[model samples]
Target: MRVIVDHPGWTPASEPRRTVRTENSAWTATAGATLILNRVGEGRDQAPAVDTYSPMDLGGSIPENLRSALEEQGPVQRLRTADLWEALATAIIRQVIRADQARLMYHRFCDAHGAPLPEAGPSAFPRPETVLALDEDDFAGLGMAFKRRPLIAAAGAFIESGTKWAELPADVLVEEVQAVPRIGPWTAGATLADVTGDFSLYPYGDMAVRKWAAHASPDIDWPTDEGTFARWWRSFAATPEQLSALTVLTLALGGPRGQDQPPS
Candidate 1:
């Protein structure tokens, strides 16, 4: 829930903004709603406003045919993180690794570097410069693999690129992420989906996603190729991001393996 703002004239004070900081708080957003604040800080009234994100518009973009199914699966919403750098870092950790293991390392990374805010739940993931400051030994202590080459390399490349994720289109974001060495389509696609909040691009390299698609919708001929999957995803649902969430349902419901638990 840590919120980071990167605009020239704005900031979120390096912490997550919560409508309800605690369960006992009086303030509460309506059920199944994401509240977005356009501006923050003591004098945000004078600062240039950040672009507003509306979930209402996001929901409307979904194809009618998939509405029922999406709803049946559960309420789905996009959460805008302070920065995509954490997403990119976690994606790198997940490359060719098991989810549980990757998750452990991800948490460890956050714990090692995150700066705890006064009331925010957990510390926000450290900034890119904080990560870049660490050496191999420091990263290795956090249970990272490959001497943390992929993470450090990717962080360096992303930092050098100087691209503002808020401004990049899906395609350009894909290209930008993929340009980094050792970061392929799967890594790039996952990063783009997270950073840009665009799930149209399928993670072709994700075995779980492919397995889910094969079992969830056997009627449709799913292709292993990334390009083909992108076409099917776009045509099937205007908001392919929903498909990403649906796949989680499929996985939870037992995908091609036909069991609640995914294959080890």
Candidate 2:
């Protein structure tokens, strides 16, 4: 009955629960008959209900073939990150790296500079001001030399207009986030998807998505090229909402599972 979340910023907490720390709050979720969310702090109001979309959102409008493929994979839900900076930072760190490497680097970066929340195993991502204050040596010390400029650039941009940026719709948010140097379309799209739980904003051409889609439906002749694959994937959906469900369900087919051990 234990659940392990493989996403960055979340750490295994107790049995059957996962916990995360944001700048102003600590949150935990336990899976049972119903997924229960608890915020661990006084003075702060309860955690707000998070809106999520799933394959069911597409209803009967989903293509029969895609629906059959997804049904074999069971249910999947995309959970939005509680912190925008954390989502953006995770996307930035993930650029051009393997998912395992990105996960390690994210933990290292957070452990080094982020504020600690003992109750939550993982540290909260450092704030924009904190990231802006770090120098080349500081980043190099954590083996994040290549990420320094982009992280600093993003931090500066976030400081300037992040509040306004958070209010934007997913499509617009991707474009606005790309304004930061070294943050390309893929990174921006990933950030938008993570922060909004809107898979329509995901970079459909991403290798993970491409790989998982092919694996999830072997009978379909998926394109090998990224651009072509993205188009082919999109062609299966009749609407933006259906497209999102298709992408999310495919990812869930190969998504990470929790282990009995704690996060490394």
Best by lDDT, which number? Answer: 2
- Model 1, span 1-264: residue lDDT tens: 112121111112233232211111212111123335432212212221222222232335444434444344443333433356666775676666666566456556666886654543444556678877888788868777473777777778768774675467778878777777788877777666555544445463245655655654566567877457656554543455445544333333331121121121
List the candidate 1 regions with Cα displacement exceeding 4 Å: 1-71, 163-167, 214-264
How displaced is residue 200 in candidate 2, in Å?
A: 0.2
TM-score of each: 0.62, 0.84
CA lDDT scores, all candidates in order: 0.49, 0.68
